[model samples]
Target: MAEETHVLDRPPEGANADWTIPQHWDRYTAEEHATWDTLFARQAKLLPGRASNAWLKGLDVLKLDKPGIPDFEALSDRLMKLTGWQVVAVPGLVPDDVFFDHMANRRFVAGNFIRRPDQLDYLQEPDVFHDVFGHVPMLADPVFADYLAAYGRGGQRALGLDALQYLGRLYWYTVEFGLIAEPEGLRIYGAGIVSSFSESRFALEDPSPNRIAFDMARVMRTEYRIDDFQQNYFVIPSFEELLRQTVETDFAPLYAEMKARADIPVAEIVPGDTVLTHGTQDHARSRAAG
Candidate 1:
């Protein structure tokens, strides 16, 4: 989700009311397809042991291995059959309400463009690779699919309560940068981590960032960094539990409670946290000191 101020009053020219545009898959040049292939090849090599099983399986199920950027129609056809989810192209970021409404109904809106070859390591906005490669795989899992839909519904309600700040945190921590615990170990699932070459390693292997158990209340009150790697990562025990906590809880009171409390500092570990790793914050400090 984007900031409220970035939301335009209406859809820009050529976009639908929902801010969706045709993916225009045929229009992609050979160079753009090559860029997708390069990114895909690297991530494919790196993600097998590092990414969640569900995400890895989704990549196979979606047949993303074929050369060139995927045709959204083909991708959606497979995804819809498995999970009632379809990917739609958007000009770029959409308003929160539009985003929530689409996801609530299981339509995943993705940016239509891919990052340039030179910017492969980082890009300011989420491109098609981040949206499709990073996120769509997890959508193939039934439980994660339900959790996202639930989050979308929750986002709508949060808007009514003027609690989007709280709701957005849940999305940021879980959907974008979340980790999941498998019997083997903690694995990367969040799109932000899985899509990132650097962060995928840093999130699990590096000792500079904290890894903490997922707590809904604590997550809502905590701040996250968008300009750099997260100093903290929240790990869920399982998708089943994640969905259970999200669907069963009512957030109105939670939001009210959070409003009265101070926002948790990004790297601060509070008393009740189930700390998995007490990071040195060495990376953050060096970056700051640089």
Candidate 2:
């Protein structure tokens, strides 16, 4: 079988220092708006019982349910009032420095493009739906908002230390694929899982992946994969706890120590793991056997 390829959209020639561009909202055709409406309506129906309260409330607070693709200006206006964060349109994925710089300054860089109807279920690169819909909702939460800003600052620092992989894992696990334990049960908070129709269900209900208690050291040392659903999802007790652990702890020493250690495989469960749900690995095994 041939490997699938995805060509990511790039910043137009002569993009500014921040690598941002106008959303040009009027440029979107009705078909594009219809696609957004379809994606929004489907996720809205699926998210209620599965998504974290913070995410659900954010969705409401931002008026994301309103018809058509969101106007970035309007979305930013509301987000600024809620959490001092604003979404900025970029051509697509920007350089790491440009990305972190925007986040550090409370500006989120989103692709101005939406996915085509044929590519609705999955797209390898983040389009506006994945960037804004997947990520921006959680930015409305104050605790997670602060953590992201801090992570951005940490990203800047990590760049100098050549320790981005360690920090990127923290993001992949928490911001993208994380879970949270609520009074009722496990709910989705990670944008990667929350934005996906399938992952939102799989991360919590599936018996194929490890669900372990959040541990700063363990998560930093772990590896993750992008082409498929995650093999592990870390569950946090609360956003406040998540913030405290990341913002308060110093990573300089930890980064220095990492040079001496081997990377932990995505599916390996080490000792002292506060094992929450022991995954059966049935999904992965089946895929491999096929």
Candidate 3:
């Protein structure tokens, strides 16, 4: 999700009023397709045991194993059949309202461009790989699909309530960097964790970040880092419970309550939290100390 002020007032030239443009899948260069393949292969090899069952299932259901960057048209055809979701291309990040509107309608807006080979490990803005590969697989799951659409609808309401920050935190912590407690162990489901080769391991195996149970109020009051791996991860018991809590609760009051409270420090564990792994925070400290 993007902040309203961070994007242009109107769509860029060549984009439609809604900020969408044709994916033009044929235009991707061999080098670009190779970059996608490189990223895909590494993550595919690493994620089998670490990623959530739902995410792995979505990979098979969507046939994401195909070579090169996926054609949004073909990807959407399969996704639309499973969960009424379709992938749309955008110049880059769209206005917050446009994003929410698209999500609310089950249309996911992805970047049309792929990252440069030299910048494979990191990119300031989300590219096709992050937007599609990171996010779309989970969109295939029924419950997660509904949860995202609901988040989009809630985002619209959040704007009216002046609560987009809180709502965005919900997206960042869950959709971006969340973990799920599988029967076998804590598994990665968050797009941010699953998409990157390094973070897929760091988020699960590293003893440097806190893993806490999901709590709506605590999450909204907390802040997160965009520059590095998360110092904290919120784990949900199941997608069903995640959806039930998100859809069933009204957030207006929650937002109001959160606004009155101080923001939770990114790495601090508070009382009443159901602590899972109390991290050493070694990574965060090393980064800071360096």
Candidate 3: 10-residue stretch with minimal lDDT = 1-10
Models sorted by lDDT, best on top: 3, 1, 2
lDDT of each: 0.92, 0.87, 0.92
lDDT string for model 2 (1-290, tens) is: 00222233454666666788888899888998999999888888998989999999989899988898899999999999989999998777677888899989999888888888888778777888888888999999999999999999999999999999999999999998999999989999888887788988899889999999999888999999998889899999999999998888889999988767888998889998999999999988887798
Total clashing residue pairs per candidate?
Answer: 0, 0, 0
Give all TM-scores, in the order shown. Answer: 0.97, 0.95, 0.97
Error of 3 at 290 (Å): 1.0
* Poorest lDDT segment (10 consecutive residues) of candidate 2: 1-10
**Alpha-carbon RMSD of each model:** 2.8, 3.0, 2.8
* Candidate 1 structure quality by residue, lDDT tens digits, 1-290: 12222235678789888899898999888989999999999999998889999999999999999999899999999999999999999877788999999999999999888877788999888888999999999999999999999999998888899999999999999999999999989999999998999999999999999999999999999999999999999999999999999999989999999999999999999999999999999999999999
- Model 1: weakest 10-residue lDDT segment is 1-10
Model 3 TM-score? 0.97
Model 3's alpha-carbon lDDT is 0.92
